[model samples]
Each structure stands twice: as C-alpha cells, then as structure tokens.
Target: MLLAGAAVAAIEILHRRYDGAVARGTLLDPSARRDRTDLDGTLNYLLVGSDRRPGESGPDQRSDTILLVHVPAGTKRAYLISVPRDLLVSIPPAPNGYGGGSDKINSAYEHGGGGEAGVRLLSATLARLTGLRFDGAALVDFAGLRQVVDLLGGIRMCVDTPVRSIHTGRLFEPGCQQMDGTRALDYVRQRYDLPDGDYGRQRHQQQLLRAMLDRAGETNLRDDPVRLDRLIRAVGASLTVDTNGVPLQDLALTLRGLPPDGLTGVQIPSHPETIDEVSYVVLDDGGDQLFAAVRGTRVPGWVTANPRWVTRL
Candidate 1:
C-alpha cells in the first residue's frame, strides 16, 4: 500500500490543483439504467475526447474520440472499447432541438449541443444502442492530452504502421518510438492514407491512451511530489468527468490499486457501408455479442473468443 499519509497528501494536492479545472456536467441517470448483476457490479464510463477544448465555446462539433471504458467487477482490469466515430446509430431527441434520426454516432455530441447536454445525449444514445448505461462520463480536451503527455515526460508510443502526418508533414515509421505532445496529436489525427481508415486512427488513439496509463502507473509520485502535482494539474485541465455525483477524491482513491497491465483496447466489429451518398460504419452481429459481453462483465471471455477484435497491445 502507498504510505497512507503521503497518499492522502498527494490526493489532497490533486484536489486543490484540480479545483475548477475540470468542466463538471450533469450526465448520468442511474434510475434509467439496467445494471446486470451477473458479475455483481460492472461499471461503464463513457470517455469522450474531443477536438474542442474544455470550456471552449463555439459552434457544435462532432466528437473525435468516443471510447466506452468498461470496467468489470473487482476493478482488476479495464476494456477500452473504441466505437468508430462514423458508426451509424439512432440519435434520440435532445434538449438541443436535434430531432431523433439515424446518423453517424459522433453526431450525438453535436446534436446534444456540445457540453453537459452533449454528454447526456451521447450517454443516452449509447445506452439505447448497447443496452448498458454509463455510470460516469468524461469529456476530454484534445489540447489537454498534449499537456498531460508532455508533463508526464511524454509517452512511449509504438506505431504499428507507417503514419504520415497531414498536418505537419512528419513521417512516423513502423516501430516503437518516442513522441512529444505535438507529434503525438498529429499522429492520432491522421486517417486519410491509413489502410483501415478511421479504424486505424481509432486504434492509434487507443494506443495513445494505453501508453498514457502505462506511463502514469510507472511514474512514482512519492519520490517527487512536484511532478505529482504537475501531473495532476495537467490531468485536471485535460479531463471533465461526471462520476454520477461521486467525489473525485474518493474516485481516485478507489482505483489507486489497479495493476499496471489493467487496460485492454478493443475495436468493435464493424464495416463501412454507404447510404444516401454518405459513408458510415455498420456494426456486425459480433458487435452485438461484444456488447452483451460487456453488459454482463464477460469481456475477457469475449476477447478470448474473438481474438481478432482485440488489439495486440
């Protein structure tokens, strides 16, 4: 166990520094959710990483990264399920005048008006699609990702395929390489030349997150409290989480003991299809199986059964 006193002090420092940095929102509705007890307690946290910054006001925009973080009971491990942005799903009526219609899954955020309301509508839309409601949600600013990465000494990313940056004209060759904040962001945003298109980008995004978590786990805050404070402050600026009213301090403490190898990235089974002159991703029957597994805390089994959908990382 981390020295109790030091851990408490570090958490308090995090709380102080994080004050008002994260954009809080009223997102989840517990009463409307159907929790499956097959594993006693399963948690699904919707983590949306957007191109827009936290508290940045502008015209509504589609979410860039839509990840369903499903933590099965015991909190021993997590599943990073990447829902393709272009996946076609039903968007329900929202307070933001977005009438219900079948559209790209990313549209839910825009339809919800791009804040707490956006989180709410996206949560509801996902629930309607997956049959599992979110226990908490977080809207992450893409800018914050860079800061968090750079503050923590940058992440060690492995590029499985060659990625040429359209934004900066930098070429990322196939190999494990070190990335600074700028290169990392540009690397993740490229999709045009990738063989798998958006799916490859989704994989890269998941890889970035895994690297961040792995780095965080490896970083020892007790040895350097200043680094801890800086890291927490950067994270605070990057993420806005709605933990269903749970205090952020307690939430941090609860997951403090998670093992370093806890995260597993997964891609939902889907294929690109066109309708009405629009290209969209359509889920396959296996996606229904995957969703069912997540709902019942059988994700590990599902991953084992369907190895192709699981990323090597």
Candidate 2:
C-alpha cells in the first residue's frame, strides 16, 4: 500500500510538471469549423517551424519549415508532407488586416504579423492551395528543438555523404553518429552543400524527426519519471499550440499508439523555375494529385501510384 501511494504521488507530480512546462497560445479561432466526412476522418495539422530568435519581436520572422501532418481517425498511421518553403503560391487577402499577394508561401507568415496573424494567414494559404481544412496548428521554435535533442542525450543519425555547413563551418562525415544539440541544428540547417538544395534539407529534417520519434519510442517516458519530466518541460518551452485549448499532453496521448513504421514522409511534387531572377518551386500536376489524396483520405492509393515522392528514410 505504501509503494502504491508513492507511485500515485509520483504520477501526479509528473502530470503537474508537464502542465506547468507547456506554454499555450491561440493557433485557430474558436468559431472556425471544417467538415471532415470527405476526408475519411482525417485530421490535418499545420506544423510550422519558425526561424525567429527567442524573445525577438517583429514580422521579419519566416517559417523555416512547413509540414502538414495528417492523422487519420483510426490513428493507425500518420502522414507528414513537407511543403517547401519556397513554393510559389497565391496568398489570399490576410484575415489579420495585412495585405497579401502572390509570393513564396513562407511570405504569408511574415505578412500576417508573425503570431496568431501569421498562423491564420499560413493556414489560409495552405487551405487555398490544398483544398483541405486544418483541424489545428502547432508552432515549434527551433531553439526548443535543440534543447529537446540535448535532453534526449542527443539523436543518432546517418549522413549519406560528407557534408559541411556553409553557415556554421561544422563538418559531418558520411556515416552514423550521435549529434549534440548544436551539431544537430547545424545538420538540419545545411542546404547549400546538399545536392538537392532545399529538397535535401527537407529530407534531412524528416530524418531528424524520424530519429526523434524512434528515440521517444525506445525511451518509455512513462517508465522514467525524471527523463519524462525534463522532456515535457523542454517541449513546453519550445512549442505553442493554437488557442482551441488542446493540451500538449492530450495531443501526445493521441499519437502514442503510432508506430515508427506507420509514419510516412511525403514531398509535394514541384519543378524549379526562376521568376525575375528569384528561384521558386512551382507545384506540378502531381502536387494536385497529392493534395487530392489527402483531401479524400486516399493516401494509400496515392502512395502506391507516386512511390517516387515518398521518403524512404
């Protein structure tokens, strides 16, 4: 009975610690609603990784990464589709009282004022482009990502080739290795030296995500109260969920049953074009088919047909 009481108390403490560590903000309006029946009970979440420095203010910040996560009703699997930041698209009139125009998709975030406004604009842009509605949105600051990796004692990754960061001067040899927080950040930020440019960077980002998820699976957080507490705190410090009031814990629980193999990475098909000397990725017809599959919840068939776009790593 004494041991039981201690265990119960420990669980309660861990819950409270997680609650306190998370920082909440509005990502969607409470009044907004979207039909999901056509989607075969899939929920779409716009996950944006911001480049803004901590405590920095202004509309200058841009979304460094834009991923749309599709979680089906059954929770049997999850699909992560990377929306290239440089994809050229038309931005509708901003809901946040800012002007919008045809530009790189990331500009929608900057035009929307970089907070709730930014999220709204980006959401709207994606909706316009994909014809799918978002159920919620999450913004993850890269700074917090570094801390989470550090807390995990570092994430192990395999580089395909010898790569060097143009910005950071860090070098990564081809092979599997453990990366600390700073090195991991550099690894994801290197695009110039990569053969595929931003596409290669996108693949690396997805690899990092897979690594993190695999690490989380290996480390049973429920069994390690100390590590779980620290991880929760790190996540809370770095993430902001929309104002619909879904707790991060609840979100984590919803995805807890997902297996690493069940997670698939997709790249939206596009072709590079230079407009007025500025390079941009123009979505191809395959991109439309991709979005349609997502909207209709026919991803399995879509993946079967367009296997080339799926990320193997």
Candidate 3:
C-alpha cells in the first residue's frame, strides 16, 4: 500500500508539471462535495470521446461516443448508460462562442472548443433532460486510451456477433478471447458490420468494459512494481476527473469496494424514428421512465424489463 501511494503521488506530480492541462471546475462546488452513501442524489459522470483525430480531418467536432455513468450511494453496484452520437436530439450550442441554435448534440463540441465549452453544453443538457445533477467528469484522448489498455496488459472479451471492418482492419470470431490495446481499440471503434450501427458499437464497448473489470480483479499489482507504476501513471495522465473536490485518497477508498459484477451497463431506451427525412432515436416510454427514476432516485418502470442489465439494489 505504501509503495502504491508513493508511485501514484510521483505520477501525479509529473503529470501536473508536464502533460497536465485539464482544469477542474463545476456548476456546483465539486471540491467541497463528498461521496456520501446516504445521499439520495445519484453520482453522475459524462464520458465523452472527442472526434478530433488528426487522421480524420473534419471542421465539425462531435463526441464520437458518449457514456453517462450513474453510481448510487452505499452500494458497490453502478450503472453505465451509452448515448448514441447520431441520435439527433436538440443540442443547445455554446452560448457566446458557438451560437448556432439547436442542432445535434455532437455539434456543441465543434462550436465550443474541446475544453470548457463542450463540458458546459453536455452538463447543462443532461440537467435539463434528466433532472439529475452530475457531480464529476473524466476526459481522455486516443493516446491516453491506448496507454490504459496497455497498462491492463490486455483484456479478455467474448465477441457476441461477427464484426468485420476493412477500414480498421478488425475481424472477430464470436467467442471469448484476450485483446491487446490495438485490437481492443479496433473492436470498440468498429460499427460498420454490426446490425445496429452505433448502438451495436456501444454494446461492444460495454462488453469490453466487463471483460476489463474481470481482468483487473484477477491482476496482481504487487507482483510487479514497475508495471504497477506504469499503469498508475497512464491512468492518472489519461483521465480528467471532476471529483467534486474530493481528495484522491478518498476517491480511491470509495472505489475499493466495487466488484466486476457490481457494474450494470444499459443503453438509453430509444428506437429508430424518422423526422424531417432524417433518422433519429426517439426516446421511448422506457427512456422517459428511466430518466424519471433517476431523478426520483427510484427504479424506473423499464427497470423490470431489464432485469438482467440492472444490478440489484
């Protein structure tokens, strides 16, 4: 434990001095917030994957991927909800800098720079749509993502359906297996072959997450100090967390109790709907009830439908 502490501290210092530019602030005083198990409010986080790669040139920047995480207090159980980027909902653009009226949620990032503008738009939209207050956020780049995967050595995953993509050079046979950083990235990014398109991609990501968690549990960090240090450094550098002013040590302690099976991953309830000749994922009754439940800190009506997906309270 002492060694792990020292290693994490060293990495934090190095990152702050060199590669650190993710400034932390919030609508609420996150610094003063505590992760109370007794609180009725859900702990929400927005995970955005920016489409700003130099390899793909585009004037418009969007979140290629979006994940909303909700962790109820006092339980090891957690929920991850993936939002489709092309769902075509009204996105309130940045106020001053990127005023283009309501558009797709992805455009908010293009209007506002990748930093504060994007975060503000996302958080505000979430509050309006779900009536739930988000407590923190974590941002990561492709490089940071690669580092995290490598740190885990590799994650084992089972391919549910055949996913073949010529662009990303990914081909998977349906079965359980191990995936390295490169393969894992390709798997999560592949959407062309899947039947549900972006929805399928989200499912794949969630599956990978489950496999990674399982691997994380089995991993023995104390066996290799060098590797542990490398992982700690990579994770710290890769994530931009809005920890509500909570100390790093305290946060770590909070996460200590989480188990692999404790995580419940769900996609926001929506099916394809056409509007103005454009396809949109209109939220169904399930979606509305889910958000309502989140706001009320109670199980939504759809929760019963997804008995397998929702962790037991």
Full-model lDDT for every candidate: 0.81, 0.81, 0.65
> Lowest-lDDT window of 10 residues in candidate 3?
27-36
How much is the lDDT of residue 119 in candidate 1?
68
- Model 2 shows how many backbone clashes? 3
For all the candidates, what are their Cα RMSDs to the real structure? 3.5, 2.8, 4.9
Q: What is candidate 2's TM-score against the reference? A: 0.90
Task: Report how far residue 217 has shifted in candidate 3, in Å.
Answer: 1.5
Ranking by TM-score: 2, 1, 3
Q: Single out the weakest 10-residue window by summed lDDT for candidate 2.
A: 30-39
Candidate 2 wrongly placed segments (more than 4 Å): 1-13, 29-40, 95-97, 243-248
Candidate numbers sorted by lDDT from highest down: 2, 1, 3
What lDDT does candidate 1 reach at residue 313?
58
Clashes of each: 0, 3, 4
Tell me the tens digit of each residue's lDDT in model 3 across 1-313: 9999999999788556433434354522222133442223456667766655544424356666777777777647677788766665555545555554655556655555555456567666655566666656665554456667778888887777898875666679898888887788788878878887777888777766677778777889879878876777676655556666665455656767778787777777778777788766666667777887766766544566766434331
Expressed as tens digits, the lDDT of each residue in 1-313 for candidate 2 is 9999999999888678777776666665333325332233567888888998988748999988999988877787888899999999988776667767889999888998896678778888888899877777788887669989988888888898778988778888899999987888889878888888888888888888888888877776778878877888888888887624445566667777778878888899997899999999999999999999998889878988898888876
lDDT of 2: 0.81
